[model samples]
Target: MNSTRMRITTIAKKELVEFVRDWRTIVAILVIPVLMFPLLFILFPLLLEAEAQELDELIVDVELQADDLPDGFQSALEYSSINLTFAELDAVENLTEPGTAMEKLRSGEVDAVVRVRANNSTWQYAVLHMSTSEQSNEARSRVLLNLGEWEQNETRNRLVAVDLDPDATLNPLQWNGSIAQGDVASKGEQAGLALSLFIPLVLAVWTFSSAIQPSIDMTAGERERGTLEALLGLPCTRAELLFGKWLAVATITAAGVLLQIAGLTFAIGYLATSDIISAPTMTLGVVALLCVAVLLFAITVVAFELALAMRAHSVKEAGSVLGPAVLLILFPALFTQVINLDGIELFWFAIPVVNVLLALRELLLNRVVPVHVLVWMVSSAVYATLAALYAARQFNREDIVTTLS
Candidate 1:
C-alpha cells in the first residue's frame, strides 16, 4: 500500500512539473483567468455604460403639427430631448399615403411623426409613428415620458379645481411590493440575486475548459509524442497512473476556477470602489462552500475528460470529442439556473451535473439544504469514481496503449 501511494505521488509530482512548464497550460491555469473574468465582468460594463451615454447624445428630429396640439402638450414636447418641428403645409396629404412616414423613418429624414386628435372631452388620441432605430426609440421614449408628466400635471389641476385631494384621486389603490425580509433587499441579498443566475454557469465552463488541455496532454498528447509507452512501463499499477494524471488535471482545473473567482472578486471590488457596481456578497464562508463545490465539480470533469482522452489516440482526436462534450455539459448547467430553484424536484439532486449547478444556485442565494449537499457530493463522487475506473481500465489494455486506433 505504501509503495502504491508513493508511486501515485511520484507520478502526480512529475505531471505537475510538466503542467507548469507547458506555456498553454500555464496560460489557461493562470494568465487567462486573471484577465478574462475582469475584462468580461468589469470592463464590459464600463464600455456599455459609455456606449449608452453616447447614445443619449443623439439628436432626434420629430415632425408634429403644433396648431392642433393641446395647450400644454406642445410645450412639454419642446422641453423633451427631441427637436420638434412643424410638418409641411401639405403634410396632411403626404401622411395619408401608405408607408409615407415609414419611408421617411427609413431614410433618416425624421425620427418620428406625431399626430394628436381630441377623442373626447377628457381624452386625446395620439399616434406616434416611428421606426425601430435607436434614435427613433429614444425619441419615442422621451415623448412618452413628457406626455406622462403632462397628464399627471393636468390631472392635478383638474383635481384642485374640483377641490379634491390629487394624491387620493390619482392613487386609490395603495398596493406596493415588499420582500419577505423587508421593504428592500439588504446589500448581500441584492448581490446574491444579481449573481445567482450567471456565476454557476461561468464556473462550470471554466472548470471544463481549464482541464481539457491538461487532461488530453497527459494521455493522448503523450501517446502522440511516443512517450506513453515509457510512462506505462513504470512499475506503478494502471489505477495509480490514472489517478495521478487525473489529480494533476484536477489541480490545474481547480486552480483556474479559483483564479477566476479571485479575478471576479477583484473586479467587483474595483467596480464598487469606482461606484460602477455593488460588491458581490460572496463572503468568506460562502467562498469556502463555493470552493468545495468547485472541487467536486472539477474532479468529475477531470475524470470525464481523462476518460475521453484515454479513448482517443491523438490530441486532435481528444479535442474533437471533448469540445462537443463541454457544450453538452454547459447546456444542462445553464438550464437549471433559470428553472424554479425553490420548487426543484428531489430527482434533480439524483442527476450528476444538474445537482452541482442547482447546489451552486442555492448556495449563491445563501441557502443550502443538507440533503442537496449530501446528494450532490455523493453522486458526483460516484460519477468521478466510475469515470476514473473506466479510464484506468482503458489504460490497462495493451491495444489502447500500443495502437493509434
Candidate 2:
C-alpha cells in the first residue's frame, strides 16, 4: 500500500507540475474565484443602487389628458415629481388612431401620458408609457408615487368646499398591516435560498469548465502529444497512473471549490446580519455539508470527464461530448428550485449530480437532514469510485496505446 501511495504521489506531482507551468489553469483555479464573488455580490448591487438614485432625481416630461379638470386638480399635480407639461390632445396625428398616445410615448416624444376621466365621484386614471423604455417607466413611477397623497389632498379640498368632514369619511374603517411571524430564519438562511439556486448554477459550470481542459489535456491531449506512450512505459500500475492523474485534477478542482467557498464567506459577510455572523451552529454545519457534497460531486464529475476524455479520438471530440452535458445538470438544478423540499422523495438523494445540488441547496438554507446527507455522500462515493475505476481500466486496455477507439 505504501509503495502504491508513493507511486501515485509521484505521478500526481508530475501532473501538477504541468498545471503550475500553465498560467490559464492557475487563473481558472485561483484568481477567477477570488475576484468573481465580490464583483457579483458587491459591485453589481452598488451599481444598481446608484442607478436607482439617478432615476429618483430624474426630471420626466409628462403629458396630461384629463376631461373637465377638477378645482384643485393642478394643485394636486404639484405634489407629483413629474414635470407636468400638459401637451394638447390635438397635437396627436389622429384622434381615432389606435395607440396614438402609446406611439408618441414609444417614440420618446413624451416620457408618459396620464389619462384621467371623471365619472360620478370616481376618477379613473391610466398612465401610458413604453414598458421597454426606462425613462418612460421612471416617468410613470413619478406620477404614481404621490397618488395616495394627491387623492387625500383633493378629497379634503372637495369635502371642505361642500362642508363635509374628509377625515371622518377617510377614517371610517382604518386597519393596520403586520407580518405573521413563524419559523424565523436568519438573514444568512434567507440569503441561502438565492445562494443555493444561483450559486450552484454558476459553480456547476465553473467546476465542469475547470476540470475539462486539464482532464482532456491529461488524457486525449497527452495521446495527441505522444506523451501517453512515454508515460505508459513506466512500471507503475495503471491504477497508480490513473490515481496520480486524477489526484492532480482533483487537487485543482478542490482548490477552486475552496477558494469559491472562501470568497462566498467574505462576500456574504458584507450582507451579514444577526450577531456579526450567522448562527454559529448552522453556518459551520452548512459549510461542512457544502464541502463534502461539492468535493464528492467534483470527484464524480472529473472522473467521468477523464474517462470520456480517454475514449475520445481527439480533444475536439471530447469537448463536443462534454460541453452540452451541462444541460443534464442545468435542467435538474432549475427544476429543484421550484420544488418544495418538504415534499422531496428519498429516491432523489440516490441520483448523482442532482443529489449533490439538492443537498447543497438544503445545506445553504440551513436545512440539514442527516439521512439526506448520508445518502448523497454514499451514493456520490459509489458513482465517483466507479467512474475513477472505469477511467483506470481504460488505461489497461491494449488499444490505449493509440486513439483506436
Cα deviation of 117, candidate 2, in Å: 3.1
Native-referenced Cα lDDT, model 2: 0.77
Cα lDDT tens digits, model 1, 90-204, are 3353333433566777788878776665546664434455556888888777777778899889989989998999988888987566554563666766777778788889888
Error of 1 at 330 (Å): 1.4
lDDT of 1 at 126: 44
Q: Candidate 1, residue 396: CA error in Å?
A: 1.7
Note the Cα lDDT for every prediction shown: 0.78, 0.77
Displacement of the residue 371 alpha carbon in candidate 1, Å: 2.5
Cα lDDT tens digits, model 2, 1-405, are: 599999999989988998899897788778888878878777888899899999888888888875556566666666446678675443333333335586788778889887766668877666778888899988888778656578878778889898988877768876556442443765556666767777777777678777887888888888877788888888888888887888999898888877887787777777564243442225777777888888888888888888888887788888887778767777877776776788689889898677887887788788888888889989999998998888877777767675532
What is the clash count of model 2?
Answer: 0
Minimum summed lDDT over a 10-residue window in model 2 is located at 273-282
lDDT assessment of candidate 1: 0.78
- Model 1 quality (TM-score): 0.87
Candidate maximizing TM-score? 1
Clashing pairs in 1: none
